[model samples]
Target chain A: MVKSIHIEKLNYVYQSGTPFSRRALTDVSLDIKTGSYTAIIGHTGSGKSTLLQHLNGLLKPTSGSLTVAGNHITSETKNKELNELRHHVGFVFQFPEAQLFEETVLKDIAFAPKNFGKSDEEAEQVAAKMATLVGLPDSVLDSSPFELSGGQMRRVAIAGVLAMEPQILVLDEPTAGLDPKGRLEMMEMFEQLHQEQHLTIILVTHQMNDVANYADHVVVMENGGLIANSTPERVFSDPDWLHKHHLGLPQTTAFAAKLAKQGVPFETLPLTEKQLAEKLAELMPQSGGELHG
Target chain B: MVVPFVYAFNILNLYFFMFRIMVLLILKTKFERERTMDGIIDIKDLCFRYSQENEKLDLSHVDLHVNEGEWLAVIGHNGSGKSTLAKAIDGLIEPESGEIFVDGQKLTEESLWNIRKKIGMVFQNPDNQFVGADVEGDVAFGLENQGIEREEMHIRVKEALQVVNMQDFAKHEPVRLSGGQKQRVAIAGVLALRPKIVIFDESTSMLDPEGRMQIISLIKQMNREEGFTVISITHDIDEASLADRVVVVDDGKIMGDSLPEELFQKGNELIDLGLDVPYPQRLKFELNKRGIQTPSEYMDEGSMVNWLSRSILKN
Candidate 1:
């Protein structure tokens, strides 16, 4: 598979030369394959957000190098030279709705495309398409973005990013404050995009369930360093390691651990609800009793 | 004449003694009635609207009663008026009709500040609420507001910090703290006021999972050990599950009110209402579909484990 993003020994420091210098990322090197779903899990101040900012040239590495969507970025890279790279990486910030400030939802979604030098007609067309893709109704297109509910406003923000037509979709806790139904819808829409458009997804989330369900690859960060980069199965296999880092397992895996304590054998850890159910069904006796109240 | 006067004096003393006994009995019953009949926080026929043009009220005829020392979680989808109801309790917004009482004091212009002093609220954004440069200063801000004495404020701030386990970060700048640490400071600030009721308005929503867990555990400790009446407005099911009672609000009305265990049994209905179904319920549905029988009642993770161990593993 082609690499969508590659980082080699990336380091970032806040206020580097000054007396109040702080290191945010240290010796971080990782690669995300094109058309793959990757989840970044970490506690706050764990350098995940810093690494994400590095992807879109929002912050340049203090040392080392990175290449996102085939655009090479180094510490010495000029700001003017990174504009082209920005078009290929759609960054959906945490609480992206906070950025919405337009007369209409259509106008808000079209803003990015217009900024990227598309004509009015072209930008509006792309905005309409992206808005529909994000499940926004046609009737809401002309309404004020501020008038919409929190979930709809969020979709408008995401549609704005999608209007840019990026190959890599980077999400920062996209479901942060949404209700469960809204969270599920947002995630499913991303899954559809991943399947239909083959866009590479890089998600930073605190929800382990999302990581288990959507992400094939998991990266665990801690205290300004990348600690683990592996498949979800391998990452979640060590309960003790995860517990020690104050990380949590998916609800399914945590439940499976309880069953393990009760002498249930697991050839492999189940990472999702469906996987756990199937595993338990295979283990139970063929003749199951009726459910009791 | 002296004997007659003495007899009159004795009779007057007996009458006074009987009146005193009658007054004490009446007062005792009134106190008990107030304590037992009314909740610590009570809302009666509360109605509110942001604008008259809107067809529906933001909060319509909502009636809720939060018991003293009860942890009640209010959950709803966005625009469902859960937050509105909470704000009404805090007198942040006046309801168009109906009444709200906190600690038995009616929510009115005259009693608003006194009611506020009895309630402490922790908002979602920690950074927005940080008023002081350092942790200690921020914790003491509330105390300093009511013109608390310097010596008393010092003792209270230290005690509040200790309760939230942020005593070590007393001198740390607000910018230096992580999201969790900042929330702890926010919580410490609330604790310093020593309010009878604490409202967490999506306080843990902005935090990461670990940070969220820390705050949730702290909330539990505050509710259980400190005996604070907790009203947490949230969308997180995990947070709601830990509460003593769950109140479901929909379209500016109370939809359902029950214990966490019972509330989750209506699994698909909850999902339809934009709320999360509990993990155990989901697992139960999956298991039942696979020809495996599980209990119909909602079982928390621990109970589910024990049942599965006894039923399936034992075989």
Candidate 2:
């Protein structure tokens, strides 16, 4: 499979010169397969954010190299081609509602496309489609962005990025402060986008459940370096390693591990509650009565 | 004639003495009533709106009673008026038609100064609340506002920092601290006020898991060990699960109030309310759906696993 993002010995330094220079990422290398849903998990100050900024050419690598959509970015890479690179990689920051500054939701969604040289009619058409794609009604398109709810504002901000029609979508904690329903809906929408559009989705989050449920690949970061890059099941299978790195397993997996310790017949760790229930039901006697009403 | 005058004077003195004793007894009863109130913070028929002309109230006819030293978690979606309730309690905004009593004193414009002294609030963004350059400076900011003596301020600042486990980071600049550490400093600042009630308005929402855990543990310590009344406004199910009571807010009204275990049992109802059922509860629901009997009381991972192993998996 073609790699959507490739990093080789990537290093990023904050304020790289005088007294306050700090190395944010060091000797980090990873590859995200095309159309894969990748989740980056780590503690704060582990250089996850720094690494994310490198994906869309927002931040130049201090030493190593990054290749995104066949464009190679290095320390000496100029700003000339960054605009082209950004057009293909949409970046959504945390608290994206703060990014919505347009007068109306429609205008906000249309802003990105207009900047990319789309005509007024064309931009509005794309924005209208993006609004529906994000589950917003046509009624809210004309309303001021500030008048909308936090979730609506977030969707508008996201639609703004989606209007650019990027192939690879990068989100940083997209559902951080949303309610449970909103969080679930947002993740499901991203999953849908990934499936239908074949968009490569890279999400940075601390939500282990999301990582377990949505991520095809998991990348664990620790103190300026890539510690593990593998399937979510493999990464979560080693509880001790996760613990040593100050991380935790999804709740169902942790519970399953406890059951296994108590001598329950379990071959694989269950990642979700439904899986756990199915596994338990299989252990019951097939000829007997039901366990509950 | 002189004997009759003396008798009259003595009778007057006796009456005066009786009146004084009655007054003292009434004052004593009033003081006892103040001390014996059921709730430390009592809100009645609270209604508020941003403007009088606005037809809809931001908080509508809400009533709440927070028992002293109890950790009450307020769960709601965005624009659900949970934060509005917090602000009203903190005296940052006054209700349009209602009464609030904090520590047996009615909350009014005249009493706001005193009420504020008993209630401290920690907002969502740590950076926005940090008014000082360093940890100690931020923690002492609240004390300095009350015109406390320098010696007393230093003592309180040290005590507050110790409570949040940020004593060693007193000299660290706010910008240099992690999101968790900055929030700890914010909590320390609130603690320095020595308030009876501390309201956390989505304080852990922006933090990573480790930071969120640290803040939750700190909140638990403040509620349990220190016996501070806690009202945490949040959408985090994990945080709400640890509370003594959970209050669901929706559309500017109180939707439900119950213990965390009981509230989460209505799993689909909670999800419809834009709230999450905790993982253990969800697991129990799934197990029940799969024809495995799991008790509703198994709301935590350890207990759920224990119950499943002993009852269902024992075969």
lDDT of 2 by residue, B182-265 (tens): 999999999998999999999998887888899999999999999999999988777898899999898899988999878877
- Candidate 2 lDDT tens digits, A213-245: 999999999899988999998998888889998
Q: Single out the weakest 10-residue window by summed lDDT for candidate 2 chain A.
A: A284-293
Output the number of the lDDT-best candidate: 1
Question: Best candidate per TM-score, number?
Answer: 1
The worst-scoring run of ten residues by lDDT in candidate 1 chain A lies at A284-293
Residue pairs that clash (backbone atoms under 3 angstroms), model 2: none
For every candidate, give the share of true A-B contacts it also has: 0.86, 0.75
- What TM-score, computed on C-alpha atoms, does each candidate reach? 0.94, 0.92
Docking quality class, candidate 1: medium
The digit string of per-residue lDDT tens for model 1 on A154-238 reads: 9999999999999999999999888888899999999999999899999999999999999999999999998999999999999
Docking quality category of candidate 2 according to DockQ thresholds = medium
Which stretches in model 1 have alpha-carbon errors above 4 Å?
A: A289-293, B1-34
Show the lowest summed lDDT stretch of 10 residues, model 2 chain B.
B291-300
